[model samples]
Target: MRFRPLRSTPTSSPTLAMVAEPPADMRAVVIDRTGPPEVLHEASSPVPRPVMTELLVRVVAAGINPIDAKTRSGKGLSQAIAGYPAVLGFDFSGVVVQSPYESHPFPAGTEVFGMLPFPRTGGSYAEYAVVPTLSVARKPTSLSHVEAAGVPLAALTAWGLVVETAHAHEGQRMLIHAGSGGVGHFAVQLANYFGAHVTATGSARNASWLRELGATTVIDYTSTRFEDVVADVDVVIDLVGNVHSDTGTRSLGVIRPGGLYIVVPTHSFPGYAEAAAEAGVRTTGYRVVPDGSALATVGRLLDSGAIQVFVDRVFDLAEAADAHALLEEGHTRGKIVLRVSDD
Candidate 1:
């Protein structure tokens, strides 16, 4: 993968210097094997110490991603698990408990929210999560812990696709499939923020909500064929997999040549890569990285009400199994979160 030239050099703030460390033996949700969410079990595990550029956070909540359950259910992510007794979770909101680098901006009490790359020991579904300082962002003051927890994976995924992958610009025409799903809603708002002329595909029930998020047009995926009504797009963020393979594959029809089609779950989709090539379109899948700086920016945006977080459900850590079941249903709007500790 190519790296973008650094837009700005990293800056240090007082918030970066104040994070604290956790004591050993904290309560955390863990999995011994991959199968069902039932595989995730509560365990008293050693609280990890942050290394250079890492911060230990006292987790208040963890965001649930569809991929999280996919990994649990032995799908695309099963091999990503190294062994049993694995901790599973990525997005988290918490207070900074410790930092190895004194130049840190998040002081011991500073509340922060962000995503961790998967397969790490510092799982977010615990009393504490260890995050690379780069991936951690200060939580937006206007949002509650549960709300902040929901932002990282889905929101960042949207940001990565709309802003980074597709390079969506103001007045550009864009289409977001599954506009009511966790990542789709954020794509609508973020793309709109960039001045894109946005169209979103979702159920008729979410049309008004999509409009509120800045979708200029909303297609009821159930009642209308998107290809039949949509055309001439600069970008398409495909969130649905084979379930809408025809729509996803034919999405190329809408893109102007030199346009982009980004599929979140197409890694396992049959002929996805080949289809993109045949259509003369550029397409790629992505895995989210820890970007503390981006999170901080998102926090500021949240505080200003430029973006809104949608929570479909919140479950206690003990109910993580139930949470995964809900996610597996595949129709949830916005995000599902788990309350770990407290605010």
Candidate 2:
């Protein structure tokens, strides 16, 4: 993981010139060996210098996602990691402290938020992070750093599933599983905002809340089997796969013939394609990619209050293990975020 040095700093910002540079090394929660949550411990890591079109961001907060827990347990993207002492985080909200070049659109001191393609590169579980210029957008003026941190990866995933893949539109009927979860909550809102009729599955406790997010029908998974009640839907966004129950396979039976069944987690099921084929429905797997342009559009929607991001809890950087523990319990209403540095 060698990086080229930034020969030219963003000197155009007078404030940037006056401020001292970031520390050479920073405090980060890291794991030398993948294991349980307790494996995450504090360590001093070199503050990465941005190269090429990258920018150095002083991370104010980082969002916790299910993938973080999976990777920590030697699953998910853990195989993609090149070495030990890996820092795992995907979504971040922070200030740009170093730009690829002077006079860049997002210069030093500019507030931004985005997701990192972790393992392929370093991640956000640190005080400072290396961010691609095109992977970030100006943070929404309406959200604080903690709130903003919760948006990127989850929102992008939902946007990709609902709008980009399903083409959510008027009269389109969509079923969203785990509707109160980090990505599920966003899926419900984006589908409704795009004029789709939403039916969501969640606990009875979350039923009213999911309705508030625009789900016309909220199925309590504890009380009712979703496949029995939901049928002939235009799209089914399955956040929970057959790993928990027969969710992925059962979801196929609900979608109308030719309807799309989008599976979010590949690790959750083994043979979804064969299941969807037998059920006579079209299917696809989805993975969220960082997109500043789409994120910028999402920022606009956020600022306008057309959609909302719910932060279920906030933990300090050192409490990353606790955050991961909560995530594994699978009951979080929205997103859980780690406060890395003060905004």
What TM-score do all the candidates reach, one by one? 0.90, 0.94
Candidate 1: give its CA RMSD in angstroms. 8.1
Runs in model 1 deviating more than 4 A are 1-21, 101-103
Clashing residue pairs in all predictions, respectively, total: 18, 0
lDDT of 2 by residue, 186-245 (tens): 999999999999999999999999999999999999989987787899999999888878
Shift of residue 78 alpha carbon in model 1, Å: 2.4
Stretches of candidate 2 exceeding 4 Å from the true structure: 1-19
* lDDT for predicted candidate 2 compared with the true structure: 0.91
Report lDDT per candidate: 0.83, 0.91
lDDT of 1 by residue, 82-184 (tens): 7767778889998888766555576677788988766855578789777877888878889999999999888888887888888778789999999999889
Which residue window of length 10 is worst by lDDT in model 1?
Answer: 13-22
Candidate 1 has what TM-score?
0.90
